[model samples]
Target: MILDAISSAAGTSSAAKDRAGIADNFDTFLQILTTQLKNQNPLEPLDTNEFTAQLVQFSQVEQQIKQNENLEAITQLAAATAATNAVSFVGKRVSVSTTQSELTNGTANWQYSAAKDADAAKFTIRDSAGKVVWTGERDISKGDNNFTWDGRDAGGLKLTDGNYTLSVSAKDADGETVTVGIAAEAIIDGVDFSGEEPLLLAGDTTIPMSSVKRIHNQ
Candidate 1:
């Protein structure tokens, strides 16, 4: 009877709370069983099989509760480790796997790796609203290449400081399309842990820690 009562309570409580309830009920169950056995009629004895089954069920419930506690501990440990790692990125410049970068003051910078030398490589700049802002020839090398913008549109007009997207197109001497992978760099200012995963804050932008490709000196 007490086991049935505790089982119903276990359904609605958390592992820690349910575990305590189960323990209390289990103690009461043992006492009741002992008293029943002692006062039981000898002609019609209490069924040992039913008592054994109840004991086994209580054992299983306790084991499951312990396992739930362990899993919670592991999850909390993992979240703490991630927050620790994210905090270390503060003030560090990291290359993120994105085509977007912020233009601060009068300059913005990006980097890309070229698959091969492009005879007609060009860089295209787009504003936050996806409007074409600037386009020009890109002097790309075989390996690493860095591109910097002066926050100027194609007509030499200064543009406002904000986020912009960079797109690069390249072609070899034979006019075949070449691969150009764009990477945006930003100095992490802080960490936002409100989300499920930590996000690195760079000024007004929020970048996921998982998108970080390289960590440079502060």
Candidate 2:
């Protein structure tokens, strides 16, 4: 019976449940063994070697279960600490590697770095519904460059304040593509822990912790 319990203990969802079941079965097994030894006749003595071995196995299993529980406790504590640290990112300005940035009031800013100078560098701005609102050419040399939008469309029409996506394509004089690194800066307003990784919320954009590059104090 104790062997069967051991087999089933692996299927238990939590360490606490496994410990409870094993403890109950171990106690019952000990009581049965003690009573049988007491009632055995001296003329035909019962060997206790098998019972002793089983007792040792049960002890090992119980010790392993206790260790698992302790490890689980440590894991939970570490998760709590990570969550607390993520929460502290709120209200702090951060720069993250992403294509999307929020347009507020009248301006939206983005940063990009170029590996080599391009003869022709063109960029397009799109709104939430994948509609291109503006398109313009930029002078992206072999260094860092900042692009700012005035919340206006291609025809000088003002657009609503919301999230915008910027896409850039560049080619050198020889028609070879230039590598560009794009990033955006925003103040983290909230955090979403529902996903596998903690996400920092910044005005309709969900930025993963791994994507963040720098933190600035407000």
Candidate 3:
């Protein structure tokens, strides 16, 4: 009987239900075999090759079913781990590559790269309303320049402590425009892990970890 063969091969009764449900109308095959044996004129019986082929097919199908179940279990485990790791990013300030953002508490920082030596470099900071809030000049060589802006207008008025966008343009000794990289810092309020890679959320923008040049503690 198919049930007997399954029980012997599986080595446990716990999987009997699974094995039995695999074959559709399997009991009908057993009934037909019994009837043929009783009614056959003893001249013909079931062919041996046919019976062997059926047994092999059953074994292959049983293996596939077990493999599928194992795969499902593995997928569930991975999903659980991703959910746990994504929560760890909450409430952390991270440095990511971005052009513009509002500076909270009237303070923001920028990183400047010099392509060539400049006699004088000018840094301009703007507020969220696109108004020039502060301007400063520095004599720097061809290198990095760090500039921080306190929320202030040209009139020397302290703006309200909130988010403000910043834009900077630098000129070299030749009075030609030089390219400078701009970056901002923000607190990671959440993380998204459903995609192929993790994404860090900084206030409103989602930034990939690849764009993160450095990390700092404040």
Candidate 4:
């Protein structure tokens, strides 16, 4: 059932793109026909059926394009409404399987795992300037382990609330470096649809729908 829904969405997106392409082609064809008529010799005129057939094809394509655009508009409106409903998540704490914590209300959480039992593990939070604001060592299990940051630097200064990248490194018993990854969950303060695509605004970070693994509340 999940696969079916994904396939349906892909098909719809593709159809919209194809419809836009057809509309563009139709416009180009109309321009060419107008130019041809203007440049045609007065004595030797263009063929009637040829011009009529082209015009008919253009009209048919135009209608199809309009229908496709209407369908797309409906889909966009539905998506926008659904996204707007997600705004209720604001001020509520939730978890999502994602990387890059979108800081909200000066708090964010992430989870990571070790491929093997790490002898040592460290969580490092970096600002946009590539400076490490916070770092801590914690014992972690082989599976997912959650970490939280209060948007503070090592000097105990409260950092301005914003998105920050996290890096984790672990060493196995044999002293081999282990790779660690993180995913953060945030409160959806609002929805952004200023552009052609919709995004979920979790604080300063605008996350795309494609990046959203799951909606927490619903």
Over 1-218, each residue of candidate 1 has an lDDT whose tens digit, in order, gives 55786568646666656477777878888898989989999999988888888999989988999899899899999999999999999999999989999999999999899999888688899998999999998557789878889999989999999999999999998888999999999999999998999999999899998899999986
TM-score to true structure, per model: 0.84, 0.81, 0.51, 0.54
* Candidate 3 pairs with clashing backbones: 102-164, 103-164
Model 1 TM-score is 0.84
Q: By summed lDDT, which 10 consecutive residues of candidate 1 come out lowest?
A: 9-18
Instruction: Please give the ranking of all candidate structures by TM-score, highest first, separated by commas.
Output: 1, 2, 4, 3
Which regions of candidate 1 are displaced past 4 Å?
Answer: 9-11, 16-18, 117-122, 137-142, 170-177
**Candidates 1 and 4 compared by TM-score, better number:** 1
lDDT of 3: 0.66
Worst 10 residues of 3 by lDDT: 10-19
The worst-scoring run of ten residues by lDDT in candidate 2 lies at 9-18
Per-candidate local distance difference test:
0.89, 0.85, 0.66, 0.70
Model 2 stretches with alpha carbons more than 4 Å out:
5-18, 39-49, 193-197
lDDT of 1 at 159: 96
Against the correct fold, how does model 4 do in TM-score?
0.54
Q: In terms of lDDT, which candidate is stronger, 1 or 2? A: 1
CA shift of 153, model 3, Å:
0.6
Model 4 over residues 1-218: C-alpha lDDT tens digits?
A: 22233335445444446556555555666676678789999999878787677667657766877897898899878877766665655555455445577566798678676676776587888877777889988767787677888988888898886668888888887888886756677667777767766667766777666655545653
Q: Which candidate number maximizes lDDT?
A: 1
- Candidate 3 segments exceeding 4 Å error: 1-88, 192-198
